[model samples]
Target: MDVCTLGDLIDVVGSPALRLHTASAGTGSPVTEVLLYDAHAPLPHAPGALLLAVGVRAAEAGPLVRAAAEAGMTGVVVRGTDGPAAEAEAHGVALLTVGEDTAWHHVHLMLAAAVDARSAQGAGLGDLFALADAIAAATGGATAVEDPRQRILAYSTVPGQPVDEDRRQGILGLQVPGSVDNSEQVRQVFAAPAPVRLPPLTAADLPRLACAVRAGGEPLGSIWVVDTGTLAPDAEQTLAQGVSTAALLLLRRRAAQELTRHQNADLLRRLLDGAADAATAAHRLGWNAVRVAAFALDSAAGVPDAERTSLRLLDLVRLQCDARYGRHACVLLDGVVYALLPAPEASGGAGGPEARTTADRRHRQLAEDIVGRAGPSLRVPVRAALGAVVSCRDGVTASRADADAVLRLLDDALPVAAVDEIRPRVTLLRLADVMRERGELRAGAWQRVLDADAEYGTEYARTLTAWFGTGCDVASAARQLSVHPNTCRYRLKQIGAQLGIDLDDADERLVLWLQLRVLAEPDAPA
Candidate 1:
């Protein structure tokens, strides 16, 4: 159903006596229904309805205006006096007044006819391209339908005039360039409900006529006709019809996109959780790469509309990923948005040291691209963590765990991390998690050494840490601890004697080193 605005009503039945009290800045409020009322009659709660006030008194105007606002009416049209302009403005409602001598029947009939005419406009539009074609043919210009973000959704097949740089770039790239995005004319077009006529930026430029495609005062996107010298009355009429048609098409497009997003999210969740056949899901999604690299985006709490902001960020990330790597998926899980990209040819058909190095570089590049592209557009600060690349066929769960582990490092200071890039710290953190699960690790000789140090204030744990950290170099270990090399040797002997272990054994040294690291920060990694 089409909506009738107070502006339309004014155009229909308004005389010199009728004046607009409140100025609706953007597209005016849309009214789909109307009600007739008297000052003393029952207050009707008809949201989105225009209320017609008949035989209203000056003193009763304030209360009636308040009543209409509270009843969720779009606006109130009354005769006799100013109709409490202050009260209407305070309640964010539109106020209009008719000539005192105008008949009540005439007022009602004019409003009804205008509304009926509104309902008849923008009817029988087949698709977005059809609407775009109609607008372009009527105005004799090139037409493109773009979202609020200026991303092109559709364009007319017929270019009615010679294309300019903006139109050509927008159609080819499917988005407005940053240079054009910052234009004052672009801002005005979004802010105005009626069509905006923008003169050329320079003598060599083309003029543009634009209008917002909106529903219920909420803008869906905009429709633009480029190189139109000046719109004729018929062209203006066509533009109005095209705006309404564009709104309906955008609404349908949004509905279909939301449905597809929900379905993809579900399938992705199952694949990440290892609860469904990942191969099947991957095939369905047209992902054929051999490795899967996951990117986890940390949620920014303590911000207004955090969920909505995060979802928008997720959409931006998905767009960037799709542009770079065609087959990628995204999902919001546990307050964080995760992206899974099919890493192409990371190992180069040889899963060796070179392959690992190649995979690391590729994953790092992917992570950087996402952060660079989506980071600036985000309202709230967000941290990004990229996981190690794993085999696509059998490592979905492992890849997610890697991503989650990387995300655990996010803090006020450390905002981004990659598991492969920080392998040593990642290793310690992973081992820390294992240490908590296996209590039997506590009964090892290294634990005894740590317990003895706690009991006798010994430096065994510190000595072992320095020694292993220096790769078993006694002098370097001593230098790191600010102690003599002989003292380091003496402590090592005491550690082996007290813990009843062999310092010469490689296995014993490895166990002692791991034990010291585990107890170094015994608390589980976040």
Candidate 2:
């Protein structure tokens, strides 16, 4: 143990007046596993989280109170001493002074050691996160850990909508069960470089917001210091500060790993964005040549945040790369895995018959891999659609369009196991073919209408559009256009003359219809 009794620990950490514990046998366990300070819980509320001992000396009473506070004790019992009553009364803490007992010495030392032990066992920030949970589980109190930005990267008993992307983001939805307010309040209170009072969650709310943090001299994040009851001022601050420091040390170590992964993903995105030189991109990416494809995976309808699932699904793509093509960045964007396959320059060219065959062959294998690997996680099955690759910039655009098409088709037909099943070349091209067969110039026509609407606003654009589509047949067009025949004819002629288009042409009619559809959604195909 670090020190022999609560009296010895007082020198290291000042004494606390409010906390109390009963350690008849020195197991160091509190009377109960839960405590609530200033709470209106049922009376005869025997403390299950902490205990009060009768024999602790009056000099030892101070630290015992501190330890009880740190350990979440509601009260502690010590031998009657000159200052005990006054000290406890001043702190507004419930105090009990009893007779001396031998267990006080060893128990006190154990408490001190417990405080020092965390520092002795040095750990990095990431490890602190796990440790916080472990502490909470053992103590049955709440704990939370937050990153440098005060964002809770991870915590025990997370709120329903916890954000897991950054280690430094504030822990949103932390509902501590104490006088402490929300997660933000906790951070601001203890946010200093030195450990201090972290406004904790309330006793009731903490059942859910138990969390931890990791913060050292600078603080990478934070680990929680939680007990069911209110802590003694001195012990409370000390333990929270010590563990929080340890948590920060662990957080920094994991920071490097997360950063490398993000950097790789970013570099790959630049290569694919077509903003950089392809040769240099290929070389930097460890590719002599490459084939790229896109897959958009959608969570089953009515599912929540399907996009977040991309991280898990992305692993499947990684599995394929590992087994076949080798390691490469696998990116998740808009619910799709923008994947690249590395190949040799020799395997690339001929630009035709052979190229099509090879592309098709690799394409099918990739499809099979994606389809085979896609499955249920978190009780939801992932569905996917894929698009064909375009040569360079064109390919990127086409893949995006195709990826979207696959998503639509998933919305339309086939329970195709996942979004990956929608082969970009095939499924996306098939959509293009359907658009062609439907006599729609989705992009060309939509853009024209959009440009017009930009100048004309909604009503006129709608009026002109409907009139044009009806072929100047006032009555017939008016009925279809849902306007008076006179109005339809007038609008048509005026709009036609203004835009310089014949009110009766096949091309103009088609364009107007495409425009209506495109302007309606703006993001989707006509």
Candidate 3:
């Protein structure tokens, strides 16, 4: 008797087929199994192979397929367009749809076709799509498209017919004309923005219809199909074989295009805003003051200008932060990174991933550090600043303040700046001024030393700044100033008297903390 494996049979038949088998006796009888059947004509099993025949009505597939499997048969083959195909699968057999109408050849020719397809090159998505269409037309089945990437580059139906733009562009509304699960299946297929199996399609599903598109893998955006509602037992076997070749071609196309990809997300944002140039429209969108994290890389960096490098770094930073902190508009003025991370209007908000978390001090610190690293890489000093999470529109306000911090420090450094120099106290000062001007500071009017006229006085500010820089250590303050420690102590006490502010109260300490930090700002008095 002759026998064959699933892979071996496809090469012999010149068509697709699933291998199945069954016992030749009643339930529980020991029946030895064998292979090598004429799947196309439904001929009797060869002398040594076990054979079991059944009416088409049996819905359960497990028992029959399991019996054949246990009997040591190589595999089972069944006509897919009939109810028995479903029954066979129910019994745990794999179904392969050969054709909708009738099998044209024996197992031997089908295997040969599968082997030839796998071995050939220059036979890409277009070629495969054409092959599906040709095979379906000749064998009596549906249309086909073999896209492994989401490119949707090519498709063809029975023989000479190919899908037109009117049909494909309007694909969203069309139902699959196949005899299988048409509506639900087509819907599921379209829902995935990537390439994947068509849904609502099942084991008994034949090749009465076909549809496919070309796409790439990685995220696996590609399409291929075994078109029909009726197929020979080995039809699915062909699909499995062709899919690997189709997927490889799809990936090749995508990899080739990766070099040209730039962030078009910004363009999408603008289209959503009813403008093609979104940057101009960004002004109208609500910007927030949430913290953002980002990193940067350059296309090529030799002889890069500091400002140009900073801008490129901003682009890279935006791309990665998109996964972490979320989308925000980028605006670089001079040589600084300015971005706005959105704050949700309410919990469970639908903002970017950054919206999932609240303001994190570490995020701010990290972004600045990465930006700072870019400065040395580009031979340009870079500094960055972050503001506390604030409400919408306040983000734009905060961005301005952060940029100012970077600029203020850039000129005072080693001709290059780093992010750590960004002073939040500077932003707080700006915030305080904004709040006071807008009447929001009424929440803590009297306690705010920010409003003290004597506070901004020069000598008193200088003495206080020097004392605090020493970490309240009088001797350090004196030595740093080349003055007596007692003199530093007297200056601090006298400044308190003039300002009329207690140095020990929690409120007073808060004020002192804000002031001392502001004093650290670049170019501020020691």
Candidate 4:
């Protein structure tokens, strides 16, 4: 396995987010961990660690750099160039600067990717940068490898290579700039069987030759190269050939990622079902938190290609949660996506009286965000239910039960809701579950009403349901059933005489109403 050095990490995570500010003796040190620096917290001695000094002023970064050096850290990344470069140099530690617009989480993701790739080097993971360089060399032009979503995975960095502003921005942002209208170009490339020449979208953009990478007829990604009219005559042919290799690499990476997802999902399922030891599972999953919550998400009914939509939603939820929490567990069971989200309890700070409320609000917001994004991106209506915040992993099962109950009760109006916010409805749902288990409505007044409706083509059941729903007000029930008040009263009188029951008995009315509601459920037995 190749050791990921500080210089290598910088190369993989390019400029506009991170830039080398000062070179020192530790420039080639291997980066084994990524740490976020806190002034008030004690800094542990982690050798070869890269520190991200988020929210720290450059002028006040002298002590951090000295501390990093003393702790055998590789480098420190700050937001401004006014950082203590001299101190870092004297201490034999490197200093790096982050772009003002770049977020700390984004930097952490980039660094984590670089470090993870290095650690998985022995697994035959293809080097995308090397492939980009190879393609650039063969075609005599700058090159970029992009996923299907137009995310730039790798790009050639050879000096003196001609590249337009669009290419430069794509490399810097690791995505196709939002300003560019390339939907038609993407469609054309994916539909073509050979390399397609795409005209420049704007005067500032360059013409390109691109080919889609496919495996088993599924589009995996694409390769794009700048066409400067200086390429070999067979440049298109070379790109066409490179697609085969790109497909293989992409397939391998996807398989590895899928394997990991399955493992995590299996463990999450066991935890949610109380089939696994809570403490051991939590430790193995790296979820170190004082509290946790469960979120159940699913698409609304009658969605086209529901299975496919469900899988897409699962992927989106996992990505969003992983990006936000850095450590989360998500799984898809029975077409619903389940996520276990940790509270903001790092270092055991969430022990206050309002800790559960704070966690509920935070997790609710995230669930709402997921549902909101799913609508515009997947073109499908989605809903999410947040469970109660629990103190330990053992309580996750109950939280999951709450989430599942809320999901079952969700309607078109409520796209996101927490268990606490809908406790009454949840309680009714639980009661309905118990009623179903005991077959409470099988041979009761409700069943008799159903039998009479079927045998005589009567609307007795409907009338009774409306009567009870209207608090036994004859006029209101008549309006609900679209009949005269006398007709409603007549039906009620006949119902009492036919069933030999008293309509004035409070206990009987309550029990009868409960049975009627249970019978109204979609899954009720005939």
Candidate 3 residue lDDT tens string, 1-526: 1122333222223222333333233122221232334325544433223332232223343454556545444334444434255444444444333333344344324443332332232335456566555545443434344223222444445553333332344233332233344545544554544333442244444323322333431334323444343454555445444445555655654442231122123322222233332232233232423432222232233445655676776765565455455334554433445555554542445664475444344455455555565666556444444444444432334434443444443332332222333455345556555544664433432333334534554344445556666676788878878788787778667656755767667676555655444333345422
lDDT of 4 by residue, 249-337 (tens): 77766764554455557667777777655664555455545233333334435676877787888889999987677556688778788
lDDT of 1 by residue, 331-421 (tens): 8776677777665444555566676667567656766666666556664556677765665556777877777777777665766677676
Q: Estimate each model's TM-score.
A: 0.62, 0.33, 0.33, 0.48
Q: What's the best-to-worst order under lDDT?
A: 4, 1, 2, 3
Q: Tens-digit lDDT track for model 2 on 185-245?
A: 5556445444444332433332222223433344455554444354343544444554655
lDDT of all predictions = 0.70, 0.48, 0.42, 0.77
| Deviating ranges (above 4 Å) for candidate 4 | 1-126, 179-181, 232-234, 277-337, 341-343, 346-383, 389-395, 405-415, 422-526
Ten contiguous residues with the weakest lDDT in model 1: 117-126
For model 2, the superposed segments whose C-alpha errors exceed 4 Å read 1-264, 273-277, 286-289, 304-308, 343-352, 377-409, 412-503, 516-526
Query: For model 1, what is the C-alpha lDDT against the true structure?
Result: 0.70
TM-score (C-alpha, index-matched) for candidate 4: 0.48
- Which model, 2 or 4, shows the larger lDDT? 4
Cand. 2 TM to true fold:
0.33
Tell me the lDDT of candidate 4.
0.77
Count of steric clashes across candidates, in order: 0, 79, 71, 0
